[model samples]
Target: MQPNQFNVDAANKLKIVSLVSVGKHPQSGRMRRADQDSRAVELGLKLTGDNHSGESLVVLHAGDPGEPNLRSYAGMGLKSVRVLQLDPAADAILPLGQHLQQCGADIVLTGVRAESGESSGMVPYQLAEKLGWPIVPRVADIVSVKGGVAEVLQALPRGQRRSVMVKLPFIASVDSAAPEARQSAFGPASRALMDIEVVSASVDDVRQAWEEAAARKRPKRLKVVKAKTAAERFKAATAKSQGDGGKVMKNESAAEQAQAIFDLLKEEGVLR
Candidate 1:
């Protein structure tokens, strides 16, 4: 009944593919295995665990096969990743959809958005359109697949969730709410083979006309404080908002000023 455990017949019969991309570290901009894509790979591995062969879950990527980060997904126990070799400027939806049709894939998993490049988060949707498969957006987890129907959890606003049943041959975009991926083992990553195949592709004319520029870092959004416990809820409901008054600590000692700033942070729950 657990997410990691599945009916052997259902798990073995269904074909699942996870599409991954090169991820960029938020601060460093270093390339790595994408976060949500890795979670999709993790879920794919979980589905294959009951069978023990890991052959049912196929990891696919449409880009350079030699990309070092692609092996990171293989480190999570995937034997190999099927890479569709194409020009970086080419749109992947056509080839990806073609491959899925050729492979007779029943379930397709993808990240909500790529960590690099245009990051429009439209690959899954576009692929679904091209393949004529239903798409479940922002999937938090794939609970089970039975009778050609897949029970899934969808991530919603404010930490809420929805359970939906999608028929077979569907696409689901993995959300950040999904389980965190396991650590990538270096040995497995080093040994994992990149199965690359050259495919026909066309450069996107629409994308070519767009202007490109460096990204500017934006200010971080304040974290929302959730009140779950009864006491916490009561505190949240009864607490009075601070006044519009500003305090000046011009005459305060160095330690007092530091303590005051720390206390302010604690009051704002930033320290916690």
Candidate 2:
């Protein structure tokens, strides 16, 4: 089914909370806005506007409110954002859970992963476990929300998509396939306000000592598939390697070129 084909209840108003985070610049190693988290905020705005159900949108953050990164989201039309102030050394899970509970939001949206330190890409699942709510990852778009359930379009590998239905009070991690975020407006950003909530939290005790090192690229490994039959084994052993080392047809007649093109397409399985 298409992404837009879904039934929605216009009367069921929803409260959606989007979590935003600061990302790091790949080349300059500087702090910058996170595209994934920003996209989630953009999707939240699209869902809450009059075109949809007119749900209320709430922006949340768990970091230094004074950070310049937070203001970037404000420029995207968020009038205010709730900031949960916690000890920098503490794990953000506990404090974030407390604030989300206080807000009484029906749906929580976040990026697939954070861009900063220890980017484990586990926040959404961890938060779901803490709140006892179902978590949907890689959501491309929210199809509809009605009858205490939400239907969403999930992104998959190979340019494919799947539809999902989850009950209310669920957490969703937006994928990059979702709509691109709008540019942050300077006027709204300058006028935006931060609502700070100080929460007491302690760092989790680590059983093992941790170490840090410079990141490096790892060599790509060839996939090894098991073959049970002799024919399958032979086919696997002779599988074509991925590279451009084929013949090139230069200086040929139109009919010959057309025949060669047809042969190449058939070889590639692009034509019968």
Candidate 3:
């Protein structure tokens, strides 16, 4: 179904809050505008224009207001953005929850994870816990918003999608499959000013000090064998790896070659 066909209440104006952050460039290893977070902002803008007419979209940041990455979002057509100035070492969950409560937004949106620094993709779940609201993760699109509820298209593995309806006052983490964000306008971005809100929040003492190292290529995954019983699992685990020693027929009779192929097929369990 098309995204616009969902039931939405035109009478009620929605207060949408989107959380954004700076991401790390995969190749350059430099700080840049986050793709997923920017997509969330784009979704917020689309929802505001398509359904909640006349209501302004709110963009929130939990880091430095002067960061170049944060400034880039202004060009995406958001009139203004609010930045919460917190210590680099502080945990963003508590302060962000307080800010959301103060804003009293009906819907909150964010990315699956930050691209830099401890990319644990846990902010949405943490924020939901703090706000006592339900979280819908990996949302592809907002199908419709009406009657204080939102119907969203959720992305799934292997090019699949599922539609879910969640009540308002919920958190949604936008997936990369959502609509791409528009290019940043230089004129607007240069003139944009962030409303910096200084927030004093305690840093989590449980976090351990860590050192950074150059990222290495990920190791290849091992093939898993599905087994239902203990004996089957043991057999699968102890099975010998296939070796490159299959027989090759070069000068055999036609019937013999065919029989050999059949035997090989039977050995591989390809034929009963």
Best prediction by TM-score: 1
Give the count of colliding residue pairs in each prediction. Answer: 0, 0, 1
Once superposed on the true structure, which residue ranges of model 2 sit more than 4 Å away at CA?
1-12, 50-55, 207-209, 218-272
Give lDDT for model 2: 0.81
What C-alpha RMSD separates each model from the true structure?
8.9, 13.6, 12.9
Model 2: residue 20 alpha-carbon error in angstroms: 1.1
- Which digits, one per residue and each the tens of the lDDT, describe model 1 over residues 197-268? 999899999988998887886434344569789999778666665555448898989999999889988987
Q: Give a tens-digit lDDT track for model 2, residues 1-272.
A: 45445443441377789998888877777887788999998888777763422236788888777888888888888778788886656688988887788888888999998888667888889999999999999999998777888888899998898999999899999999998988888888887888898877887566125667778764333448799999998887778656544566778889998998788778767788
Q: Tell me the whole-model lDDT of each prediction, alpha carbons only.
A: 0.85, 0.81, 0.83
Residue pairs that clash (backbone atoms under 3 angstroms), model 1: none
Give the true-structure RMSD of model 2: 13.6
The better-scoring model by lDDT among 1 and 2 is 1
TM-scores, all candidates, are 0.78, 0.74, 0.76
Which candidate would rank higher by lDDT, 2 or 3?
A: 3
Candidate 3 has an lDDT of: 0.83
